[model samples]
Every structure is written in structure tokens, then in C-alpha cells.
Target chain A: MALIEVEKEGKDMAGTQEKQPVRVRGFPFYPHFLLREVVVMCIVIGSILMLSSLFPAGLLKPADPFDTPSPIFPEWYYLYVFGFLKFWTFDVGPIPAKIIGVTLPMVVWYGLLIMVPFIDRNPSTELKDRKFAVGMGIVVLLGILYFTYYSIVNH
Target chain B: MNLPDMIYKWFDDRFKISELLPPIVKHPAPEKVTSNPLYCLGGTAFLCFLILAGSGIFLAFYYKPTPEEAYKSVEHIMTAVPMGSLIRSIHHWTANLMIAAVSLHMIRVYFMGAYKNPRELNWVVGVLLFLVATTFGFSGYLLPWDQLAFWATKIGTGIAGSIPVMGPYISLILLGGTDITADTMTRFYAIHVLILPAAIIVLLGVHFMMVRIQGISGRL
Candidate 1:
């Protein structure tokens, strides 16, 4: 009788252990994650297709090596760098202004960006808590915008 | 067994796709990121890349890499080929949008502090991807072989030439000479279509894998 009772207890323990839930980390990725992605992708692609049909890209005159166009600038994204070249014309002794202009912006931009993960020791992800970092981002954005505008107007 | 089951059993015995697909198909994504619009930027940028690839392949069918024929070929595509202008426009617009979307995605990641701890390496890969995308833009700009393309490239190469010590070498390597000639066009063409695409794809794969393993970062 005692042996049978012990066997029953063992079976009960095994059943309970088997019933313990597996710790699920997050939501199922298929229907939920994939559905959202599909929707966003559709919107993006549909808009691009619509825009392409509505307004086709223009082709300019063939390239001439001898003749340089007035107000020569790169695409809109590069306007900031072009404007930076024009703006930072002050010369330092020995070093050319062009090098300073180019190197300074490149260094500042990539330096801060690459250093962020290392320097930003704050574990918090809150915007209000990361005031300095957020402030710096806003300032850099405004600076780029201003330079881009300057390039457009001056050109 | 039924025909469908028989077919499945045959394939499952040979490939084991049924065993392989479940984990991938049912992979978990962080609950916080599922509903957020900000998290969608990366996906959006990737979509733009897909558009670029499809449209670029179409453009390549008619594009000529030589200086003499490059401009004329582009013009012909725009004016002559069926739906060519539309494809070209899509490619152009998609490139611009990809750059914009990638920039915004990086900014969002930064502000969200998604580049913390275990995710830092992916952040570096993201930065390299950004640089590669910008290079793609620069190289592709010259391929149109127009007045704007020519001058813009000259100025761009000039900027590289101004970079203190290695400036001259970098410019020389880019141009394949002192000036923008036939060689420069070929180099840009190769880099735009071949080198950049390969590098970006590999980096993107790494970036995606890291994201998958790490899951999404916690909400701010």
C-alpha cells in the first residue's frame, strides 16, 4: 500500500513539472510583426511608384570638361558640406582653411557619433533624462539645416 | 496518407524544411516595438533599397558605361524605352528616400539609446552602412554623365584632394587619374553596382542577425 502511494506521489510530481510553463520572451513574430512590416512596405512602395509616374526625373545636357557651370553644387544632401566649405574660410597659420573646414566638420560629426555608445554611460533611455545628448542632436540638426539653406541661397 | 501529406513527407524527409521553418517563422519580437511607428524606419529604408535594386537592374539593361555613350544612353532610356523613364525616376527617387530614411533611422536609434551595451557593434555596422549608402549616392551621381554630374564630381573629388596627407592618393584612386575621364566613369560604375552593393548586403545581413539575436531594446 505504501509503495503504491509513493508511486502516485512521484507521478504527480512529474505531471506538475511537465505542466510548468515555458518562459516566452516576446510576442509571436509571424502574424503580428510581419503584418505590420507588410503594411508599411506597401505604403512606402506604393507612394514611390505613384511619385515616379507623376513626376519623372529629368536628364541634363551632356557633360563638358572644359565648361564649368555657375553655382556648381552637389545633390541636396551634400549642400551642407558645400556650404561648410564656403563658410569656414578663416585661415590658421600653416594649415589651409580648406583642410580645417573639411576635417573639422567630419571629425565633429563622426567623433561624437562613434563616441556616443562609449561616453553615454547613463543606463536610462528616457528623453528627459538624456537632456544633454538630445540637446546636442537638435543643435547639430539645426546647424546642418542652416548650412543647407545657405548653400541653396548663395548658389 | 493523402496526396498533400505524402508530398510534405517526401520533402520533409529530404530537406527538413518543416523542422527548420518553425523557429524562424515564430521568432519573437519585443512587445514594445511591435506597435511603434519609430521602429518601422529601418524596414522602410530596406524597402527603399529593394526598390532601388529592382529599378537599377532595369536601368542597367540599357545603360552604357562609356563617357561617349553614357549620356545618350540615359536620354534614350528616358525618351525611347517603354516604362524606362518611370523606372529611372523610381530608382532616382528611391535612392534619395533611402538616404533620408536611413539617416532618420540612425537618429531615432540614437535618441532611443538603442546603441547601448550589447547593441553597440550593430551601431557601428549601421554607421558603416550609412557611409556605404552615401558612397552609393556619390558614385551613382556621376554615372548620368551630364553637366551637373560632371561638375559635382569634380568638386567632390576636389574635396577629397584637400584632405591633408592622403588627399592626393585618394583623389587619384577615385578618378583613376588626375582628371575625370573614361576611367573615372568605369570606376564609379563598378563601385556603384558591384562593390558597394556586395559590402552593404553583407553588413545588412550582420545588422539584421544581431537585431534578431538581441531582440528590440527596451522602451525609454
Candidate 2:
């Protein structure tokens, strides 16, 4: 508050001759903001270095079409889709289980995700005001987590 | 004046550096953003991306896209080339870290309601970038042509092929045929090195520009 007052006073003192640029309330972007970013970058790079050295990337044998490995998995991020496919057993009317399984995670899930801002018409950013949206976000997050776990454990 | 000052003045005379510096140099980052750790996620992801790009270029120097030579090339890189193993490891870790950071950044944006109002387009761009990043991982996964790479891609393409309507076409475009072959390796290599990098650069530009124009959610 005091800093803003000083800026306001500084602006007024400039009068009509040399107007001061309207400064936003916060630390200057130069050394202050970028310094923090550099710090975070260093930390991130250091962790990656440690992790890479500790457990280097693995390599399996050359690909042989005839030899299929048991319990083959996609990348970890896609595990939820794999899990959902395995979990869903029943058919929805005319649509087969496979179609629904693939469509639900890949199509419907991403479609809803892409449409979130539109779907959530509420303009409020506060947590208390957005119970429904927050609740839905939690539900989706938990669902993904559950499925990722399911994909690994069941297989 | 010093040599550096002379050089700076030469460019300043031509470019009007003083006028160009104010908007960005004068503007301050919001207090909430600087103080909060959650705000770091997006920048962290960007940093990871830079590392991946550097390390990936190094790995690419020795990597082969052909089916027969691809595995051997990677093996040679791991065993023979100087610091090749370390570079490959760095690339691997940075790629995973980038995906994790991107996901966490999305969660932060969602929870903070930063995706609402004027920032909606930016949010969409963010989602697109996430897709591109994951697609980058998927394409790179198949490049080594090892057993794991081959089978994982087989499963991945199979899953895409199972999607209704556009499923088969997407698979066809991805695999370049009915099955994974030499063509598939080349396609994945091209997508990983060329297509996705171009997409990511454009998307990132839009994303950053939107944030600059709209400002962070803390202001609202």
C-alpha cells in the first residue's frame, strides 16, 4: 500500500511536462522476477541431472515381431486410458465396450477438458464461489489417478 | 566509451532501444506470482523444454531413423560416442520432467481459475501445447526401435486405431501402413524432430503473448 502511494505521489510530482509510466503494483520485473526464475531453473536442472545419473534411461533388446513382452504398457501418462479400457467390461446398448472405452478417455475426456472454460460460465475465481467446478475437477483428477493405478496393478 | 558501450550505442541508434525497453523493463511481475511457488510450474516446464531441445539435438547427431540401423545407432551412442549415454539420459529425464511440470501447471491453472474470461484462448493453447508435448514423447519413444519401443508403439497405435470413425485413418496416417515397419520409424522420427517442434514453438509464442496481454489471474 505504501509503495503504491509513493508511485502515485511520484506521478503527481511529474505534473504535465514529463508524465511517469503507470507502474503496476509489485517488484520490478528485471532483477527481482527474473532472478527468481533463474533460481528455479537451476534447481530444476540440478534435479534432472541427479535423476539421470542415478537411473539412466533403459534399453531393451532389438525389436522382434514374434516375441511379445508380457504386460506391455504405454507411457505412464497414457496409463489411465489403458486402465479405463481394462476396467470397463460392459457394453452400452449398440456400442461395443471397446469403442466406448477408447472414446470415453480419448475423445470425451479431452473434449470436456478443452471445453472447461466455456462449460464453467461462473466468473468467480475464489474457491468458495466455485464449489461445483472445483468438485468436478477433483472428481476428474481422482478418476485419472485411480485408473493409472489400476492399469499398473491389475496388469 | 568502452567497446561494449560503443556496440550498444550503435544498435541503439538504429533500433531505438530506449523506447523498446520500457514496456517490458518497466512492467513489474505481480507480487502474488513472485511469492508463490505454484506460479513456478509453467516456467519450470519451459526450462525443461529448453534442456530437452539441447539434449535432443545432441542425441540426434548419432541417431538413425531406419529400422535396421536405429537400434544399433542408439546402442553405438550409448556405448561408443563420447558422453552419449549422459546426453541421452539427460534428454530422457528432461522429457519426463517436462510432461510432469506441464500437467502440474495445468492443474494450477485450473484450480486458480486462471483459464476463465480473457485467458480462455490461452488456456486452449496451453492444452494444445500439452498435447504436443505428449505427442513428442510418443514419437520419440518409437525412435530407438528397441523391443520396448516397438511393442509400446504397437499398443499405442492399436489404441488409436480403436477410436470410432477417425480411428483407422489416424492409425494409417501415424503408422503409414497397416503395420509398424521401416516407414513407421521414419514417420515417427519426422514427427518428433520436425512437426512437433514447429507446433510447440508457435503455440508457446501465442501462450506467452496472451499472458502478457491479459496479465496473471492474481490481478483479477
Candidate 3:
């Protein structure tokens, strides 16, 4: 009888703990709508709308497809590719800088990408297991940053 | 209960859905959540795309996409519109930045082996998204109707014509004619402003839902 009572008491305590309500007080304000996505969307849209309001109302000249402007360059995004041509100013160099600048980095990036499933043989959750992947990611990220900055600054 | 009260109660019951499911329902099992700070890159890319869509809509309100008036409209937006140049620059920069971010995100996934096993299809979807994004870039490049746009598009369309068996057919379809004429701009405008956007919306939905279902493929 004593043993039965002890077990019953323990079960009662467990049930109470399980049923206890959690109080979500003092937490940061999380907006009902998607907070981050909404904020970002607003910034981007607002900036463009703001730009539209400033357009030269009567300054529009007729479009002529044949008229090419001086220093004709693609949009800012293509600046990287434009900058890439600068690096490719040789016929045969070590690594073919253009290939390395554009194609080879792409090859290595995508090649390493395709081989990932095979290379990551371990299923461990430890950070040590992911060190190589993380290291490679840092290198690639830094390279991209270098390219983007160079595009903007040099151009 | 009265009819109105009954309807209210029904609505309230339907809304209280968390009460229906068992509290501890588990299927795939909870994996350890990642503490990686860089995981936010995906979120950032998603955010930027949303921004692009909103801004593009606003731009569309005033944008006239014709070889006759495209450049003028862009110029008007720049000189007359308040902060127009800044907006254009931001949108332009963001589009490029987004491509970089998505590429980086894909690379991160690849290196982390997150693209293996059950995630292979997601990787394929990602490749399609990349292709669509490049097309978006290409189409948008011509919207300004500038010199670079004219020549670059001429070269690009010419490449389409060089595709061997269906080269001429492909070029004709893309150009809507033999040369870089008004028809070409119109087709590209429709593609830029309509088709790609719709495709992107659908694909983004799929990609995001898959991510949610699979729950960030880390430590797998």
C-alpha cells in the first residue's frame, strides 16, 4: 500500500508540471505580420517610389535604339563581368585569369558543390565535422566580396 | 444558442486549432537547431526579392516600355521624380546583390551537404531558379533602352540565332523579327514585367514551403 501511494504521488506531480501554463511575458515584440520581410520589402519599395516622384516630368527625349552613349556599360550588376575582362588581358597565363576570374571560380564553386554529398561522409552534428565546409564557404564569400567591392570602387 | 452566437462560437472553435492536435506529435523527429549566424543569408535573399517585387510594381506605374519612350521615361524618373535616381540605383544594386546572395546560399548548402539525400530535388529547383533569375537580369538590362542595353541585347539575341538546328527559329521567337527592333523590346518587356515574375512567385512558394517542411537542412 505504501509503495502504491508513493507511485501515485509521483504521477500526480508529473501531471501538474506537464499541465503548467507558460507565461510569455517580457519577450521582445514580434509583429503579427512577418516583421523582417515586411520591413525589408518596405525599404526597397519605398525607395523606388520615392525615386519615381522625382523624375524629370518634361525632360523625356525620344528613344533611339541606334544612338549609343559614351562609355556604354551594362547595368551595375554586370560590372563584375566588365571588371573580369580587365583580369583576362593575357593570352596564356597561369590559371588563365579570365577562366580563374570567371569560369574557374565557377567551376571550383560548382564542382565542390556537386561533390558535397560524397565528401561529407560523416553524419555527425559536431562543428568539427563541418569545419572544412565552413572554411570553404568563408573563402568563397570573401572572394565574392572582393569582386563586388572591386567592381564598385574601380568602376 | 442563438444563430449569431452559434456562428461566433464556430469561428472561435475553428481558430483555436492548436487545441485539436496532440501536444507532443512528432514524425521526422526534431533535429538539433543550428546556431549558425550565417543562416540568415537565405532570409535576407528572400527579403530582397520581396523588396524587388514591390519596387518593380511602383516603377511599372510610371515606366513606359517602348523604344520610342523607354529612355525618356527612365530619364524622367531620374530627374523629375524625387529620389528617383537613388531608387533606381537601389533596385539595380539589389537585383545584382540578390543573385550573389542566392548563389552564395546555394554554395553554402552544397558545401554543407544539405543538398544530399532527401534534398536533391530542392537543389534541382534551385538550379531552375538560378536560370530564371539570369533571364530576369537579361530582360531587365534592356528596359533602360541605353547604348549598352542595345548592343548587349544585339549580341545576346545573335547568340540565340547561333544555336544550330533551331538557331534561326529561337532567334526569331526571341527577337519577334530578324533585327533588334521595337518588337524585341516589347517581347522582352512582357517577359521582364510579367512572365518571369509569375514564375518566380510560384517557385519561391515551393522553395520556401519545402524549406519549412524540411526545416533548414543543417547537421544532417
Candidate 4:
């Protein structure tokens, strides 16, 4: 060991030495490495352009304020909710829209959310141990599903 | 070979790795992950937004914003244009879905206490985005140029007028006068295409930047 150190010292003195300096790399401001997300955005934008090009300028009848189109509807996603509004006339009936649509679902979701950070006994990572989160997540999802079902059936 | 030669050879062969390079401290093995729920939800909502934008841009191509042409244009798109109804349906559906997804995402964030401390500002921005999204909905609703649009705008503008002080002025600004006319369509069009979208785009950028910086909230 003594001999080896002496030889290495001699080499350093002769300016035949190398040092491995520690350095840190920062996160990419432009992560071209994230090609997948960029590609997806590009493809979506391109498709919109393609569809717009395919659609002709003059397709439907002229605007008439007095005319009410058949099956008067907002867009489809809104159809379910709008359909719920149609039941507004049934206010004093079994289920109220405010309770079913707004208050109850909100309460359930918030209750579950509030219970999350406290409920998990073994939270290992930022990603893992979302059991409670997932549980609460299901409530919102189910509400959407139920709303959609109600909309379709009522219509 | 002598004893030392034999011993040296044996030790050399026994620990060939150390002869070449010193052994490193063993690192803990990383656990396998199945899915990232944040990415999944965010990606899904993003996909829905893409769908909405695509269908919307297409609708815009044939959409005449003037009161004279607006209703006629929608009818033309529905009847004459190929897949017009389908496109319109997808556009409308996706917009509603985006709103639904965004709302759920916010609730999820709130419940998880993801908006605590450093995230509180992001929460405020999220609220702003929601307001902008509602405005987008309101502006788009009046574009159809029918009895529904007319009456709905009347009610909506009336609601705006209840705000006191500037309320009536705001309602007038929204309707482009006292009534829903060609001017009203122009106002809604400007809002839907220009004002609301611009606000949403800017806020969305900030919202996403905040999320990325804060990282996903810790498991509860």
C-alpha cells in the first residue's frame, strides 16, 4: 500500500493525474425526451385540422330564431344533466336534483377526501397508498355513471 | 509454483471482481409499479379536451356566427355536411366530459388535501379555470341561435343583471344591447372564441405548471 501511494503521488507530481469531480444535472426545461406527450398533442391538433377541412362551409338550413329544432338538446355530455333538468317539474317527487346532483355527491366525495391522509396506515410513497383516495375517487366516478344512466333512461 | 504463488493465484481467482475494481455498496431494489393514477386521470382528461377541440374546430368551419346565418349554419352542418351531426355530437359530448373530468379532478385534489401550503395558489387557479369553463359553456350555449338560445340568454343575462351596480351594464354588454340579436351572437362568438378560450389556455398552463412543480400529493 505504501509503494502504491508513493507511485500515485509521483504520477500526480508529474501532472499525469485525473480527478473525477462531482456534478449535478438539472431537470430538462425542454424534455424532448417526452416525445410521446408531444406527439399525442400534435396528432390531436392535426386531426382537428383534418376534420375542419373535410367539413364544407354551407351544410345546414339558415338560422331561424322562432324555430325549435326537434329533440332540443345541448351537446351529448350535457344531455344527461339537461335531461335531469327536465325532471325539474317533478321537484316535490321522490328525488330532488339538488340533493341527487349537487349536495349528496359533493358530501360523499368531500367526506372521503377528508378521510384520506388520516385513513392510510402505511403510506409508502407519493404514488402508492392511495387506497382511500381511490375509494373516494370511485364515488365521483359512480356519480357520473349514475347521472349518465338517469339522463338516458329519462330521455 | 511456490506456496505464495499458489495462494496469490487462488485469492486472485476467488475475488476476480475486486481485482478489477472495488465492490460497491448494494443498493435497494426498486419496487415494480403497476400504474400511476395521476397520469391516467390527467391523460384521460387531456384526451377528452383533444376530442372537444377537434370537433369544435370542425364545427367552427361551417358555423356562421351571425344571427342570420348561425341557426341556418347549424342546420346545414346537421343535415348537409358529412358526419356533421356526429361531429357536433362528439364536440358537445366531449366538452361536457371535460367539465365533468375537471370537476372530479378538483374534488379529488381537494379531498386528498393536495391543495395545502404550496398548493393553495394552484387551488385558487383551479377555481379560476372552473369559472372560465363555466363562461365557455354559457357563451357556447347562446351560439345555436334558436328559441332555446334566445330564452336561455335572456335568463342568463338577467342573472348577470342581478349583480347590482354594474350588473345591468354587464348584461347589456353580454347581449350587445337590450336584446339577443345579431349583435348578441357576435358578442357570444367573441367571448366563446376569443375571451374565454384565451383565459382557459393561459390558466391551464399555469395550473399544469403548478401541478408539475408540486408533484402528486402524498398518499393518504
Candidate 5:
């Protein structure tokens, strides 16, 4: 596709027209993006309101530091990390199990995610062309699902 | 011509909203990117964040930060104050939904390879935004001062405390001491309402700006 060249008047006294190349891009933001956003906003707000009314959040008894609860777990999002820590109990020689378990998975998971664009230098954006990237993504997704399930069941 | 026009002209002369906004509103997005509904998850997450912010502000009116009165205040909000329960519930559920939406958005970005080249920095910013949003959840979870909240925080911080040499110091910083005290509750409350929200808002601004500048990535 040819780049679209747009002409604009320059700020100099000559008032010369400068040609700038504009990348032919997506749909216009006004009606396309804005209208869809409005609809999504309404749906999200409406559903949340409906859900809240149907099932109000319950307050448990006041926190007691003296009495520790059994099977304490963080929110669902952190359950994968929790489960990873639980499963990787073996120590690596001098390193403590907790440190290795916590740091390793975090480093690997976050490292891979944050480093994706840098690591995958392939030019093609196609899925088939990026088999390794797609496979890795699927692996991470399944790992999260499995670990979350394990954390819940074991807890 | 009229009062409204005069006011608009005045503002436009000062702020240049008329000159600036049209280009942004009329920005072009790839047809392939715009066709897919999956690409909208980030906006959905942002919408949920807006709801959470509104409901959270409403909840804050009745919430107390002290250990002695925190639970009582929450109970009052839930039982005594009109629409308090609904507001609190919406805040809670929307937080979870935001996390879900962000996760799905990240996944879509990943599978679509939208993080390539000029968009790399935005991806990093996105990851930071995700972390800040979850931290918002963790901090806000403790505000109720309920049994589950206490235990969950204890374990969550305990996990943090397992970070080798920096563990103890990190725990100290998070708890504001050795244990979960009134100080800890106050700290969490401040972080939730002040620090995380500020960070998230700034990061969101950058993320959106980057997306606008780079344009949406083409479909696979």
C-alpha cells in the first residue's frame, strides 16, 4: 500500500507547503471507536449494577490477628502464584524454596511477557508465521488455569 | 455570535481544543483491527475502572481507616446507609471485572502480535498498569477489616516476605511494622485511594496516547 502524503502550510514566512507521509490507518475514531466504547460502557455499568443489587457483598466478622484463619488465600488472580509456590517446595541447594519458587516463576512469566516484542523479531503479524509465540502464549494461559484450579482445590 | 459562541471562542483561543481534538477524534484505525470485538477489551477494562472509581468514591464516604472502627463503618455502610451496599458491591465486582478485562486484553495483544516495533514501550506500560491495578485490588481488599481480608493480606504479604534478602524490609514497608496493625490498615487505605489510583490514571493516559500515536495493529 502507498503511504498517503498530506500537505500542510509551514510556519516560516514563506508559507511553504510541506509534504508529510501519513500511514493509511484504521477506521475513524469518532463514530467507530467512540460509539462502540459508549455501548460497552453502558453494558458494563448496567451489568455491574444488576449484579450488585442481586447479590450484595457480605461483610465477615472483624479481623482478629490473634486467631489465624485456615487455608488463607489471596484473591483469584494471585492464586496461580500461590499454587506455584505450593507445588515448588523443593529447595535448590543453598537457596530457600520460597525464594526460588516465588522469584523464578515471577521472573520467567513477567520476563517473557515484558520481553515479547524484543524477543520476537519476526516481521510477520500472522499467527501461523508466529508459531512459537502463539504456542508460548497458549502454554502460559493453560498454566495459569491449571495453577488457579490447583490452588482452589488444595486450599 | 452568541454567548455560547463567545465562550467557545475564548476557550479556543486559550486552550486550542478546537484545533487539537478533531485530529484525535478523526484518527484512523485499521479496518482489520476495528472489525474484531476482541480488540475492545482494553476499553472495557477502562470502563470498569471508571465504574470502580465512581463507586469507590461513594464507598469512601462511609469507610473508616482505623482498626477499631473500620469494620463497624463498613457494616454501617452495608446495612444502614441507602445504596451503600450496592455501591460497595459494584466497586468489588468491577475490580474483579477490570482484572479479567485487562487479562483478556493482554492475551489478545499477545496473540495478535500487537507489541511489535514501535509499540514495545506501550506493552511495557501496559504490564505496569496491570500490576498497579492488581495492587489496587490487594490494598482495597484490606479496607473492610474483615476476617477474610485480614488473613488474605497476611498471606499475601507473607508471600512478599519470601523475596530473599529484601523480604523483611518489603514486609515492613507493606505492613508499616511487623504485624497487621491500625497503621497497616491506614497504610493500605492510603495506598488504595491515593497512590495506586494516581499511578493508574497517569499510566492509562500514556497507554492511550501511545495507542493513538502508533495506530492500532493490523490483524493476523
Candidate 6:
């Protein structure tokens, strides 16, 4: 009977805590937070303008379907996919190597990436607490860098 | 009240601007988030998106989407149209920078484990946004219709077409037919100008709305 009373008291305390107004601990968004965003925006805009004035966007000669350009490259971001297609040359079981190449990076990798938050059930946010996730991220980063380099070099 | 205050008051009287703004303008930003340089990455990406949208609209005014007119129009924009080259260049550079910012932002999110628990859906939305951003890049460069653009897309679509079950259909839809043609050019233009922008705006709305609702997941 004593234990039940104590549990009810604890539940009541928890309920009141939940009911109380949450004092959001931080500075206001206006002026304090937004001032920094504005500064960053100015910097980003200035750099973009400077780059535009200097480099200017390039336009190659008119496309000729018959003459495929040598050393063709996709947009820089897609280079890893391009690189991977070039890197993987062997097949597994029934699926052809090319099929695996396309599916692995394009399909399978994306599935894995999208599933990250769900897969990493670790409740901790600290860097040291989530070693495996951090390690996998590093490996993926390095692999992408390596593949990007490979695409450029091998091209 | 001053001149600006009078204008604000005009709106406030009509629309209850005071009531509307407090949620957004006076909302608390986490102390750690404000101090941390890494937190700036997402905002940087958003700024780039704004720049891209502005410059893109300007470029679209001059850009023609047909096979015959596409390259010619781009050439005209580069050499003939007033401030066309500069606007186009700004669009180009901002597009690249936005992608970089998004990538770095995602990396930061991943390492920090900000995507756990209630934030999982936002992370998925983020990854989808990244995919959409890259698709924006892929579909975009093809609009210029340069030799590099043509061949690069051929390789890109060729690669896409090689996927297992849905490969052929995806490539066919993207390319419009067997190869990149007039149909493909117009289709890509429609996609770059219409489809992607609409999709991005919706996704961004959800992304920002979720952030505001959940607040920043960054460790305090």
C-alpha cells in the first residue's frame, strides 16, 4: 500500500512537470540568431557574384551525337557514380557486373543512406558514444573521395 | 512611431502582424546551435537555394528549351543578352555551392546523430532533398545542350538505363524515347524549370516546418 502511494506521487510529479511551461533556454531568433544568418548570406552572395564575374559559366561547342566527347564527365556531384561504374568490372552470382554497379551505388547505397537514422538505434548524440556510425561515415566519405579521384584519373 | 514603424503598424492593423511574427521572430534558437559554425551549413545551403532561384528565374527568361534553339539561346545569353552571362554564372556557381553545402550539412548531421528518434523522418526528407538537388544538377546542365552536356547525359542516362527492373522505364521517361532528342530536350527543360522547382519548394517547406516544430536536434 505504501509503495502504491509512492508510485502515484511520482506519476503526479511527472504529470505536473509535463504540464508546466517549457522554458526554452536560448536567445531570440530575431537580431541574435538572424543577424548571423544575414552575415553568412551576404558572404555567400558576395562570393557567388565574384565567382560569376571572374570565371563565368562555360558553354562548349554544339553537341554532335555522332562524335561523343572524349573524357566525358557528369556534374561533379555525380562523379562518384560515374567513378563507381568504372571501378566495378566484375559480376556476382546471377546479376551482371554492370547491373550490380548501377544498382549498388544508385539503388542499394541510397536505400542504406535513407535507412541510416532507423538503422543506428543508438540513442546517444555524442561522438564517442557512436563509434560504429562515425566509422562507417568516414569509410563512406573516403570511398567517395577515392572513387571521385579514380573517375578523374582514369578518365 | 517612425516611418518603418508606421508601415509595420499599417500591416499590423490590417493583418495582426504582431501576433503572426512572434512565433517565428521571437522563437528561441538553441545557444549551442548559434555558437557552432557547423550549424551555419544548413542556412548556407538555404541561402544558396535562394540565390539559385533568383538567378534561375532571370536565366529562364532568356533560355530556350528546344534542340535547335537551346544551344543558340544559351550562346546568346552568354554573349549578347545584357547581364545574361553574369546571371547565368551566378546561377551556375550558386548551384554548385548549394550542393556542396547540402552535402556538408548532411555529413555534419550524420556525425552529430541529430537524426535519431523523433528526427528520423526529417533525415529521410533531407536525403530525398539531396537526391532532388543532384537531379536538379543533372537535368540542369543538360539544358545548355553543349557537347559535354550531351555526352555526359548520354553516359548518365545510359547508366540509369542499365538498372535492373525499373531501369528501362526510368531512362525512357527521362530521355523521352530511345535517345536524347527534341522530346528529351523539351522534357528536360520542363523538368528543370517546372517539376524540380515545385518539388524543391514543397520539400523545403516540410523540412523547415519540421525543424521549427522539432527545433534543432543539435546537442546542447
Identify the candidate with maximal DockQ. Answer: 2
TM-score of chain B of each: 0.96, 0.98, 0.85, 0.80, 0.95, 0.95
What's the TM-score of every candidate structure? 0.91, 0.95, 0.62, 0.55, 0.91, 0.92
Candidate 4 TM-score over all chains jointly = 0.55
- Candidate 5 per-residue lDDT, tens place, B72-125, comes to 999999889998887888888899899999999999988888898889999999
Q: lDDT tens digits, residues A1-155, model 4?
A: 53354334334433422354212111111232133346545654465445545653322333445664544444344444444444434344776554444323333434444444455444343433556555656776675667666766765
Q: List where candidate 1 sits over 4 angstroms from the true fold.
A: A1-26, B1-7
Count: clashes, candidate 4: 9
For candidate 6, give the DockQ.
0.48
Per-candidate local distance difference test:
0.85, 0.88, 0.63, 0.59, 0.83, 0.88
Worst 10 residues of 1 chain B by lDDT: B22-31
Compose the digit string of candidate 1's lDDT tens values, residues A1-49: 5335434444443454457743433445666679889999989989888
Question: Clash pairs of candidate 5?
Answer: A26-B29, A26-B30, A27-B29
Q: Which lDDT tens digits does candidate 4 get at residues B189-212?
A: 989887876787788799778766
Q: Assess candidate 3 and give its lDDT.
A: 0.63
Cα error, candidate 6, residue B208 (Å)? 0.4
Q: What tens-digit string does per-residue lDDT give for candidate 1 at B109-157?
A: 9999899888988898898898889899999999999999999999998
lDDT accuracy of residue B212 in candidate 4:
60
Q: Of models 4 and 6, which has the larger lDDT?
A: 6
Residue B57, model 3, lDDT: 80
TM-score of the first chain in candidate 1 relative to the native first chain: 0.78
Candidate 5 error regions (>4 Å):
A1-25
- In model 2, state the lDDT of residue A118: 90
lDDT of 3 at A24: 19
- Tell me how far the alpha carbon of residue B155 in candidate 6 is from the true structure, in angstroms, after superposition: 0.5
Better of 1 and 6 by TM-score: 6
